[model samples]
Target: MSVKEQVCSLSIGIVLFPNVTQLDFTGTYEVFARLPNAQLYLLAQTLEPIRSDGGLTFLPDTTFTQAPALDVLFVPGGPGINGKMEDEKFLEFLKIQGKQARYVTAVCTGSLLLAAAGLLQGYRATTHWLSLDLLEMLGVETVAERVVIDRNRITGSGVTAGIDFGLALAAELFGDAIAQAIQLGIEYNPQPPFNSGSPQTAPAPVLARVTAASQNVQEIRRQIVQRVVTQLQTTNKLNHIYFA
Candidate 1:
């Protein structure tokens, strides 16, 4: 096959879980789906209508068993990541697909799930700003950036960063010309009414309220993170011993 045919025929799989933040995946989908001959797969445990945190529902195209080997594997996060951390089967599935994927990526807290799957081990990654420290505790060198591409493991910070991640992935997969054309088609110009996107830009009262609201989630994630890290460490030790 020619270079163009190879690029066009590649597969892109996006993992769908219960309560995933739709924009985290969709934003990237909007970009990647624009790639020439891109075959996007929505994968889940089953071919059901998976719901998002914001009440949106999406029908998955395939299940774990039916999923094909993907050139790109994407994971998106929301409140769902907390629950998925304990799902051994799903983590195993991720590990299997991720190891074979040309590019393994996540947006928002999705990276935490990747970490739990042992895919982000020793990689520099990023996630939602509020959860950066939590991700760091998972044995990843977490970076604070809109998008981080450490080798083939690309990660994006927060929800909106998914667009940037997609474009970057597209550029890597195809070329800057294709990525730029997609960006132009989407008209992804950002102009927020308020300058409160990040903690540094938000006012004290606004930041305090936001932090307070997420305190419960933070606490719960902290608990899960500790367990996940411990389990991964144990698994690593056992694997080392067995291999030795």
Candidate 2:
């Protein structure tokens, strides 16, 4: 590698909490792992094997307490983040690291945790379509797109959007030539058989059923988001007073 490239090595850390959606991490992991100067770390609360929502288990390379300063802090969303959003220490860790990282990123509902940690205030962001309202509730200007980038905060719309998020970040890091190479390596051209990826195109009946089925989960998310929002507001007020 040339001297210019030699200095490009970056510390990239992805959260690996239990019940995380593996694809949310793995899809991007595959891209970053192959990048010219990316050093990837799987971070979790423990070093034990973390089971993903799909039942796949992966071991963490480092615990949150042991994680190094990261160039990029990536959070992947799943049912798991529901509890982590309420974890004060975890939130504090994210808040500190996110502020320091060059890029604060998330795929799917991971944006919720970032917002809960008070990182998304005044930023235009996106998340899993179902959770966009939850993001708005937390004071974020939600964008309904595959990927939204506002300053250093980048977010993906939903699960499959992780791949796009990864490529976008790849381009940002190594330039279009390198990103194209990575995309070619992964055969990243996507042409789905179904056109129903979003509610706008999905059949009315199908969308209704899916919405109905997820009502309970949505309610739980709303309740939890309300709590987190309150906490964030209180913390911001305290910080204001302290700084004043």
**TM-score of candidate 2 to 2 decimals:** 0.96
How far in Å is the alpha carbon of 175 misplaced in model 1?
1.4
By summed lDDT, the worst window of 10 consecutive residues in model 2 runs over 1-10
TM-score of each: 0.96, 0.96
Estimate candidate 2's alpha-carbon lDDT, on a 0 to 1 scale.
Answer: 0.90
Per-residue error for 210 in candidate 1, Å, reads 0.7
The count of residue-pair clashes in candidate 2 stands at: 0
Taking every candidate in turn, the Cα RMSD to the unseen true structure, in Å, is 1.7, 2.3
Residue-level lDDT of model 1, residues 101-190, one tens digit each, is 989999999999999998998899999989999899988998999999998999999999999999998888777888889999999888
Q: In terms of TM-score, how similar is model 1 to the real structure?
A: 0.96
Each candidate: what lDDT? 0.92, 0.90
